[model samples]
Target: MNHSVTLKDIAKALNLSISTISKALNDSHEIGADTKQRVLDYAKEHNYLPNRMAKGLKEGKSRSIGVVVCSLDNNVIAQMLDGIHKVCTDKSYQIIIMQSKESEKLESACIELLYAGGIDGILISPAYETINFNYLLSLQESGLPVVLFDRLIDKIHTHKVGADNFKGAYEATKHLINNGYRNIAHLNTNTILSIATERLNGYKQALADHGIPCREELMVSCNYTGATSLNENLEEAIKSYMSLENKPDAIFTATDQISTRCLVILNKLGYRIPEDIALIGFTNTELADAMNPPLSTVHQPAFEIGKLAAEKLFSLIEKKNIDEDFETVLLPIDVQVRASSQPSNK
Candidate 1:
């Protein structure tokens, strides 16, 4: 058979009618097991692919999943995408990935294009600048399913999968405090997302619980602009922290980008990891262990988060008459110790 082999081609080759071939392919009750096996063997031999467009036209479903994220370059986001791909491919659904670069306007354009392209559903990690969920809410209300993952929003109630940011931050800060670092700084994104606030609160709670005062000047919120500006802001924040009369002895960063990038900025400024100032942050980069001092990090279960998000989205897509209540799944995170966050003396 040729590259575009069809039911007719298989039927002609097997000396069977197109109806028999179609029924066998569809696993209809009328098709005998022996005959079905014969047809399947022949179809598999010739690499037969179903015309999904035709099938979608009949069933009114494109069988495609649209995914939107801030960017596809990060190691954590890449792992999440792999999980999404694994589930979608296993369930015979195609994935279309788009990046918003943390811009709400770009994210909206991506969603509009996906909707116009007849996607069955969407799995999105909203941009940091995204404050309006009205558009997504309208689409979901109109029967287009949506499930949030990673950086989530609460305006539109639906299934969401993310890591326990509070717990991760708490553990990171607690670890630093336990190492005799009272003046611990926190580097976080300037966003209204629960991730930012929860992590910030966790850091504060850890400090309060440990009887250490939380320094207002040490809690710096970096803007979510492009990379150049972000690095500039982070450098300035670090410089200000160093100039403080009682600056931080250890630093805990929030998001993946802020975590890894802050380390680079600190090194560039000639700060010694752990000896002069300890460092830890939330990140999933494989190179964490390969950094100058082998960075400590709070690692989120990004792959599992992605898989669960897609699963929940599909559940919404194939909902039955019996409506189901939405759920928010927050997975645990791990705090991996490294030399970067060792004792201040080390």
Candidate 2:
């Protein structure tokens, strides 16, 4: 009564064994309904607390997962987190979230901390600077399940879930071209990341398919991660394109941040959307509809990606064989056309 009540204390007070008290508290079917109710009521009244560390020791799992993302400032990331949280809640599991902020050191530290914290599984979106996946490999080798989502790697053989970047980018580019924009530019991210590289390829392929030659100078890479002056960098890229003698008549940005930023930069520079330079971007931001010209966008299935990733991680965690076959799930994307990408009046 003085100290925290334990299963032993509950058993002694109720004239039952410690095992019965524990099972009743856990709602085990082996215990009678009347006895289970009595135990639950007594525990609620007395505030009987179970030793979580001891339970984890017995089960060899913490019943918790660690989630890492590059950044959560974007609407896509926020929606993805909602999806992950939903699955975790349904499964009666807990999650610890972390942000890498696109730093390799921070990403590695997050993984290490999660592993040391006794997490049963990890869901991660690799940072832009994360080139080495040895730490992830080590975690899996040490009996922890890991599922990568969004920004994944080719070196690690693990479960992955992401949107089809190639198809999305190609569709966006073709949409712009079909809208009567001949000279188009691409605002991209780091080429090392699969997301960026795949998108760039798709844009080029779309141009080739339409008999439009790919112009190297029109392609500009934006460093969203670890950039000291992101706005200045993007402004410079935009100015460079606009200053060209045969500048781009339209632009397509690869990521959510890049897309939104391009719109802001273009507006600030006095370029009219769809009239001066048509614009299309890959983003999930709801405010895209409220833009001055109603921005066109390639919408990634962020929520579905998060849900699939978490479900896959749980599958790996619960399975007996850690080396079972892994999978890479690619969800489709939707291209929403708006006034920003259309020069003609609807």
Candidate 3:
């Protein structure tokens, strides 16, 4: 095995104290420019890397963050994790990622493990089945920094970052209406999280604005943590919508997974998009444009959300105070109109 050089090795070579070497490398005012340059040059020549973990431990920080999300299978979550990794790399910090698999029990266990593992902070996107947000609250109360991203929970007040779910869903629904799609149906996750409720309300608001009566039968919440698979739940919901006396001319989905999966299910069921029924949803999949009839979508700034969330968690950790007013950031979302949502006459 290759042995890595440590500060002690550099100190011994330079015949200087470890304290002086550390101060010089850190560019402390106590160290002169000449000394700093010499230390930097020698360290570079020897290919020395600072032991961040050790130094962070000495300073009462782990220099590592815990990231908890639903799953890495989704492109949206993957993009967000990419942003987090980039920021962590730049900051000389490491990230420990864990998946909740959209289960509240599993999400709680992840948080507990991260906290017990001595992570400096946590950035979590609550699972759809999560409701006992107080679990995170207990951790925050115990001085462990906590930040919420992607799916914001109002129960715990901390630095929150996510997309504008309401406006995103609203724009998708409104676009379908403008394109002559009436009797629009909405499909969302079976959860009480703000992300779900906000999107559902957005769809309702758009319908009301257009003088269309909101029908409960036109909306369905797909169960994610049930005995059946999410695919089966979605199929049942879609079938129910089609059986309605006044079937929707278009359907608006409320999440990244739901958005793309809805499209795929529709295709598998032999339904012609835009001709049989138009479709649009909030998704950030790269395959959207390549789909047989391209998909219209409400695109969220997933990467930015992740980046900001990680940055905010660091700020909170450094501040060592969560009593101050926390920031709730909602980044704007884009409505991408594609062939799947364009009127057939066009």
Candidate 4:
């Protein structure tokens, strides 16, 4: 196996000191412009890469931030990451992204790896099975800053940025009720994440405010999974609800992907949306508009959530205390009333 090129090799080849090569490579103003250009040219020609581990050990910073998400295949998370990448690039910081695949063990291992790599900070949307707060707490105790995005543990006091899930759910449910659909079903994820709980609370609040009785049986919990598994679970939930004596007249999905699956199942079952059962979903996506009956949904600021989380994490890493005014940043959500949940034009 070919060994990686180092600064020592570059210094030796140029007959210059390691410090001079380092400064030149970094484009330090103290180094002569000609020497800096020459070093950069040589490094580029040789495809030389600095050893991040060695640099991190010497400077106490890796100039890289670690981000762990449940999955990279998730559209919402993908968008969020795009924003994070943009900001990190703008600030000349590198990012290390990891997918835990919804496993607590894998998430812990990824965190350990990032810590060992000497990351400057961490931003995470923890796995659904994440119950061990000790790992996160230990990082904080050891002076490693972490910012939680989208999902959070209430018991762990830390910086967090996400949408107003409660408000989004409330508005969605309230819209259904106002449209004269009292029997509403909520398709939610089976997890202890604060976002899911908050959304559920919002749904309940909306029902109470509208004088609609909350039915526990109407709530269906399923694990986050692939489209096939999600679709099967959704079909079962819809069938169970439709089989009930008091069948739901409307459904509020916890996510856009779930909403799409519900539409597919409804079509296969020969149920016309808004005519037989209205539908609303969380998370605004392009597919929402292209559906046979455009899906009504709550638009979340996914990119903003990522950007704010990164900004807060960097602030903490810079030795700035943000504890005095720790806040739950709630970005605004807009409800797009589409044909799926809207009253029939006929």
Per-candidate total of colliding backbone pairs: 0, 0, 0, 0
156-267 per-residue lDDT for model 2 (tens digits)? 8889899999999999999888777889999888648788898999999999999999999999887777545567778999999999999999999998888888898899
TM-score, structure 1 vs. true: 0.95
Q: After superposing candidate 3, which stretches have Cα over 4 Å from the reference? A: 226-228, 320-323
Model 2 gets an lDDT of: 0.89
Model 1 bad stretches (over 4 Å): 1-3, 27-30, 344-346
- Deviation from truth (RMSD, Å), model 4: 3.9
TM-score of each: 0.95, 0.88, 0.94, 0.83
Model 4, 1-76: lDDT tens digits are 9967788999999999989999998779899999999899999999997776676667777789999998887778
- Candidates sorted by TM-score, descending order? 1, 3, 2, 4
Can you write out model 1's per-residue Cα lDDT over 50-116, one digit (the tens) per residue? 8888877777899898999999988889999999988998777899999999998999999999999
- Best candidate (score: lDDT): 1
| Candidate 2 residue pairs that clash | none
Q: Which prediction has the highest TM-score against the true structure?
A: 1
**Global Cα RMSD, each model:** 1.7, 2.9, 1.9, 3.9
On lDDT, the stronger of 1 and 3 is 1
Report the error of model 2 at residue 120, Å. 1.7
lDDT scores of the candidates, listed in order: 0.91, 0.89, 0.89, 0.85
Ranking by lDDT: 1, 3, 2, 4
